[model samples]
Target: MTEDSASMAITLSEQDKTTLRIAAYGSVTLLSAAGAAGGSPHKIATTGSIALGSATGLVGHVLAEYPKSKELNGRSVADIADRVLPALTAAMSLLKEQAPEEAENFRSTVITAIESATHHGQPGPVVADMIRKITKALDAA
Candidate 1:
């Protein structure tokens, strides 16, 4: 994060931070699950997560602090999506309201993560669909 952006006086509660983390990391998890059929789930998660770790600005600061794994929902793609997709939209809305400047940063961070996750190989229809849904949710805000 640049010194200026890092010092931006944005306010966010713990709940809001958790929401952003879940939305971003859970996005990678969802992609991992979707690509499990004939893809490297580990690689999908690793790259996406790494991309998130590379985020800049307030989004970067929030994302750098990992969420409690146990707090993340879902054992399946559908279940996870139910929790994460809304979180994705909610996260966007929260950022737009609480930190309007960081809103685009958050969106770009998630998309970069998604692209990193899928760029490992030819993403199948399932992965592609997941990406579309994620993008939709992010835009829903």
Candidate 2:
């Protein structure tokens, strides 16, 4: 957390933190899964996760803590999206309502992670589409 965020009056509940964590991390997971058929899913996941871990500010504080929530269980990509997409929207809504700067930080962090997950060159059609959905969800709030 930065000095600015630390000085803010914002106080998020545990569940809210969990939602943020899930929303951010699950995005990387989605990209990894989407690229599974064409390339190295593990590489995508690792690169994206590293990006998330590199986040800063209040969003960084929230993401640094491992979330204990079990709501991310999804046997398929569709199942995962069903949970993550809404979580992303919810997280943005919550943050924007309380701390608008943090909201932007979170958005940039996730977008950076998504871009890093591609690991060079342009993203494929499927990954690009998934990225669109993720961005849409984030902006939905």
Candidate 3:
């Protein structure tokens, strides 16, 4: 199969993946010290949720626009998960210097984002495994 075809073999849409990707980035940022310091922990968490939901909704709309194009179906859930974890870790590191509370909130947001992402396709176990692997490295740091 062609590379595009191979990637698109999965049922999930590119828009779905992209939404998750964007949510991952935004969620990671919310976990950053700058994000937490700029607002309350609850606020940061709630905003992150809203941002992720918006991205996911956009993904749904985008998927509807290209119902037959597998181009919009490319990418496995694992691939999307890979993008999320590293971004979160990096964001946390940069924000660590700001304060302990910020770091805690940042970590909290990352965890919540992972939880939300898991609620989509496949089982929660698969998503949890990816999150565990990524956090393993982060925890070591």
**Residue-level error in angstroms, candidate 1, position 124:** 0.5
List, residue by residue over 85-116, the lDDT tens digit for candidate 2.
99999999999988887899999999999989
- Model 2 spans > 4 angstroms off: 1-9
Pick the TM-score winner: 1
Q: Which residue window of length 10 is worst by lDDT in model 1? A: 1-10
lDDT per residue as tens, model 1, 1-141: 655455366878999999999999999999999889865889998999999999987788888988888756576778889989999999999999988888898999999999998886678898999999999999999
Model 3: ten consecutive residues of lowest lDDT: 63-72
Ranking by lDDT: 1, 2, 3
Residue 69 of candidate 3: its Cα lDDT?
26
Which scores better on TM-score, 2 or 3?
A: 2
Model 2: residue 49 alpha-carbon error in angstroms: 0.5
Model 2 lowest lDDT segment of ten: 1-10
